[model samples]
Target: MTAIHDVAIIGGGLVGASLAIALEGSGLDVAMVEAAPAGAMPAVFDERNLSFAEATVNALAALGVMQRLRAPTGAIVRIHASRRGDFGRVLLEAAEHGREAFGQVVVARDFGEALEARLSGVAGLVRHRGTRFTGFGAVGDGCRVLELAGEGPPRMRARLVVAADGATSGVRDALGIGASRHDYGQVLMVARLRAARAPDGTAYERLGDDGPTALLPRGDRAWGLVHGVAAADAEAVKALDETGFLARVQDAFGWRVGRLLSVGPRSAYPAVAVRAAALAATRAVLVGNAAQSIHPVGAQGFNLGLRDALTLAGLLVACARRGGDPGEASLLSAYVARREEDRRRTLEFSDGLARITANPGHAASLLRSAGLVALAALPSLRAGLVGGAMGYRGDVPDACRSGAAR
Candidate 1:
C-alpha cells in the first residue's frame, strides 16, 4: 500500500466502484477513495429507483453484481408511450423484438449493497473509505500526486488518475477540463407508489409540453413515478399532500395502470445536461457523471456512465497484460476515441427527446406526432429507439453487449 499504485480512482460511487470491480484481477495496483463512511447509506440518496437497461444488466450479471442483490428486481417486458392531447402513440413489446425482457429496476440502496459486497473480493486492493480527495498535481515523473484527507495517507502517486466524483467534479476541475451546462428549465419529481392494478411488467411514459411523466414497475409490486414539471411549478407541486399529489399524477398520466393508491416520500432534481469540453488530459480522465450528466427523461444517465467505466477498465486491463503504461497518452487518447460515438449519440438522444417534446411550435408538434405514429405503425422505425433504450447505442464495450462472453 505504500508504493505508488498504477491507478488512483476518486469518488467511489457506482461508477467508480464499477471501474474498481472491473479492474480487480487485472494485475494493476488499484485504490479507491470514497467520502462516505463504510456502510453509511444516505437515506435521501438511496431512495432513488434506477432503470437498468438490458446491456447494463448483462454487464453487471457478468461481474456478479446482479447476483449479489438481496431484493427482487422488476422486469420490463413492454413499453407504452403517448402524449396528452396527441393522436399518435407507441407500444413496444419485448417479445416482438425477440427478447424476453428489456431490463430491470432496482432500488439504489440495494444496488449499492451489491456493489459493496463484490468490491470486498478484489485481492490486495486498497480502500480509502470516508476519505476526501483534495486535488491532484503532476509529480513530474509520469505520475500524479493525489492529496487526500481522512484515514488514508496524505498523498498517493499513480500513473493514471480517474475522476468519478460526479456532475460537479472537483477532480475534473482540478485537471483543467472545462464543462458546458444547459439548464432545461424542468425539475423531475420522483417517488414510489402503488397502483390499484398491479404492474404487468410494462413501463409507461406520458409526454407533455414540459417533459415526460414516467411510471416504472418495481419488484415490490409498486411503481416508480418520475414526474416532470416546469421549474415555475416545482414548489407548488412539491407542497401538495399525498392525496393531491396522487390526483395530479392521475390527471397527467391517465388511467393506463389504474388509480394510484399511495405514495412514499418524493424527491426533486433539476434536469440539466452537462458535457465536458474534453474527455482526457495528461494522465487523467473523467467517467460517469463527471464526464456528462443528462436529463433523466430517457433513463440513459447511469447506463451511459456504466459503459464509460467498462470501456476504460477493459482497455486498462488489456494494456496492463501487455506491460504498457496505463497513464501513457496513447492509452488515454484511445479511451476517449473509443467512447466518442456512444457519448455523442447518447447526448443527442437524451437532449433531443426533451427538446422535441417541450417545443410548443406547431411544426415541432406535428413532427413529434409523426415520429410517434411511425414508431407505432412501422416496426422497423422502432428499432432505433429500442436499441437506444436497450443500451446498444454506439461503440458498446464487449462487457456491456448482450450475451457477451466476458
Candidate 2:
C-alpha cells in the first residue's frame, strides 16, 4: 500500500529542507528525499558564504531560520561593479535604495545548521536522508507514486512532487522536462582568504575580458573570492600551489582588496544557465537550481531559488486552505504563471551581463562601460537595478518579504 503524502520533495538540500519547514502546520504530509547518505552529506570545508537579499533575509526570518542564525555574519551595505581597463562603473548603495543593507551574508555552515535545526521539530514531516528516488509513476487524481529502496514498499504518494534535486536532477529527467542548457565553458573558482585591507561591508565585482572576479566581505579579516576561469584551465588552477593560485587571482583582481595574504583550498563550479521547459506539470513541479540554474555573476542563483521555493510553498498552503489539491491543474498553473516573469528577467539579466563583460574587443567593453555609467548616473535606473539585485520581482509571496520559511 502507498503511504500518501501531500508533498514529496526530491532533494533535501537547503531549498528542499526549507520547503519542508514552510508547509509544516498547513495540514499536509511532507516528505523529503536526500540522495546521499546521512553521514556523507556535503559540508562546508572552509569559509563559504551566501549573500541574502533584504527580501530573502526577511523571508528566512519569517520562516524562523534567520533568528536562529548566530553572529559573525556580514551585511552588504554597498556593491561596486566596474570593468577592468575601462572607465565604466556602477555602485549600489543601500541608503540610495532605502534599504538598511542590500542583504546579509552568512557562512554556508551557519545557514545549513539553522535550516536543519528548524526542520527537526516540524510536525508531520518525514526526512529520508541517504535515500534516492529511483522512479515515480503518475497515479490517481494527478498524484505520483514514488519508488525508493528504503525500509519497505511504502509506495509513497504525493499530490505534488517537487524536484529540487539540483542542476542535474534525475527527477526532472524522469518527468520529461527538457531544459535549454548553455554551458558557458567557464568554471567559478571559489575560496576564502585573508585580505591585507579590511572590507568595509562592500562587495566588489571586477569584469575581466576572460571572466568576472567578485570579492564579498566576510568578517574576521577574511573575504570570499569567486573568480571565473576558462574551463580548460580549471583543473590546472585548482592543482596550483597556494602561491601560484594567489598570483593568478591577484593578476585578475588587482589591488582592489589590498592584497591576498593566504587562501584556503579552492572549490570550482562550472557556469551554466538552464531553463526547464515547464516548471509545473500534471502532478510534479520543480524549484531552485533544478528549475532554472543561472550564472553566479550577481549571486542571483540561490536567492532566486529561494524565491521559487517560497512562491510554491505559499501557493500550496493557500490551495490546501481552500480544500483544493495542490497538484491540480489550477493550482500548478497558478504557480507557473506567478514565477514566469521573475525567472525570465533574472535569467536574461545574468546571461546578458556575462556575455557583455566577456567580450575581448574594445567596442563591447565601451558599450558595457557606458551602460554602467548611465545606470549609475540615473536615479530611477539605479533603483531598478538595485531592486532586481535585492531580490524584488513579480508577485513575491508574503513569506519572502519576511524571510520566513513557513
Candidate 3:
C-alpha cells in the first residue's frame, strides 16, 4: 500500500521548505518534492539578496529556521526613498516605529543552505529531492493522486498538494491554473558592491528616468545592487566593464551610499508581474511565486509568500488537530479568505510603485514628490507605510503573531 502523506509540497524552494518546517511535529505526514538534488542550491539562489520583513523574521524564528542560518545577515534600520529631479525624499526609520530593525537582508544561497540543513531534523517530514511533480488526479472526496517522474508505482496519494514551484510552475500548468502576466519592459541587474563608506543599516531606493535602483545593505561596507535598465538596454548595461557599470549605477543612484568602489558577478532578469487567477483549485493550492510573482519594488515578493506559507501551515495544523481533511472545501475556502486581502494589497502596492516610479511625466513626478514629502511630514501616513512595509497588514497568522509553531 502506498503511504498517503497529509501534505505533499511541490517545489522545495524557500516557501515550500519553510512550510514543511512550520508544520513540524504537527502530527501530519508531510513530503517535500524538489527537482534539485539534496543540499544543492537552485539558480535563483545564486548570489541574490532577499529582504525579509520583521514579521517574516519573527515567523522564521518561530519555526526554528532562523537559528539554523550560518551566514551573517544585514539589518535594515531605515529606508530612504527618493527620485531623480524630485524635490522631496522620505525616510522611514525603525527608531520611529520602536523597533530595532524594520527588516533584514540575507543572501539567497545562505538561506537555501540554512533551509536544507534544517529540513533533515523536522519530525515526520520526508524530503524527496531530485523528484519532479508530473501532475495529479482526483482520487476521492478529499484526496489527490500525485504522479512523479521517476520509478516506483509512478503515483502516490496525498490529502493536500501545495505548489511552490516558482513563477513558471509546472504543477500550476498541469493543474490548468491560468496566470496574468505583465512585462514591465525593464530588466534588473544585480551584483554585489563595495562602497567607500559603510551602509549604516540603511537601504536606499532611487527612482530615475530609466527605472528604480535599490541598494540593500549586505555587510559593513558591502551592498547588494539591484539596478533596473530598459529591456532594450540590458545587453549594453551588462556589456559594460566593471568600472563603467559602477559609474552608470552611481550616476543613477547618486552619492547616497558614497562612491561605489567595486562590483562582483552580475545577474540580470526581466521584471514581470505574474498573478494567478486563483490560489486554490481542487485539492491543490499555490504558494510563493507560483501563485503570484510581482516586481521587487518594495521588496514584498518573498515576504508576502512567506505569509502565504505560514497561513497555510496554520490552517493545516488546525485541520489535523480537529481530524478534518486538509483538502476539504471549507479548508480551502478559509485559506482563500485569509489570504485574499493581503495578496491583493501587496500586489497593488508593488505594481503601483513600479508603475508610478517608472512614469516620467511631469505631473506624475510632481505627485510622487509631493507624496514622498507627505509621507515624511505626516505621521499617520508614515506609520501606515512603515506598518505595511513591516508586514503588518490584514490577518496575522498565529504562527507569525505568536512566534510559535503551534
Per-residue alpha-carbon lDDT of candidate 1 for residues 67-152, written as tens digits (9 for 90 to 100) = 88999999999999888767798999999999999999888888988888888887867988888899875666778889889977
lDDT string for model 2 (1-406, tens) is 6778888998888788778888878987788887656654444313466888887888888888887777477789999998888886888889876777898877777787787778778888887877778887666855789988764344678888999988888888988899889988899888887778887889889988668898888755588888989989889888999989899888888897777889987888888888898897678999998999898888888889988898889888888899888788887888889999889899889999898888888898778878988988899998888888888887877876664344
Candidate 3 per-residue C-alpha lDDT over 108-193 given as tens digits, one digit per residue, 9 for 90 to 100: 98888888788878877887877888877666845789889742346778888999999999888988989999999999998899
> Ten-residue segment with the worst summed lDDT in candidate 1?
39-48
Tell me the spans in candidate 3 whose CA falls farther than 4 Å from its real position: 151-153, 402-406
> Where in model 1 is the C-alpha error above 4 Å?
1-3, 42-45, 402-406
What local lDDT score does residue 55 receive in model 2, on the 0 to 100 scale?
A: 78
Q: Indicate the residue-level lDDT of 80 in model 1.
A: 91
State the weakest 10-residue window (summed lDDT) of model 3.
397-406
lDDT of 2 at 205: 92
RMSD, one per candidate, in order: 1.6, 1.9, 1.5
CA lDDT scores, all candidates in order: 0.89, 0.83, 0.88
Q: Pairing residues by index, what is the TM-score of model 2?
A: 0.95
Q: What is the TM-score of each candidate against the true structure?
A: 0.97, 0.95, 0.97
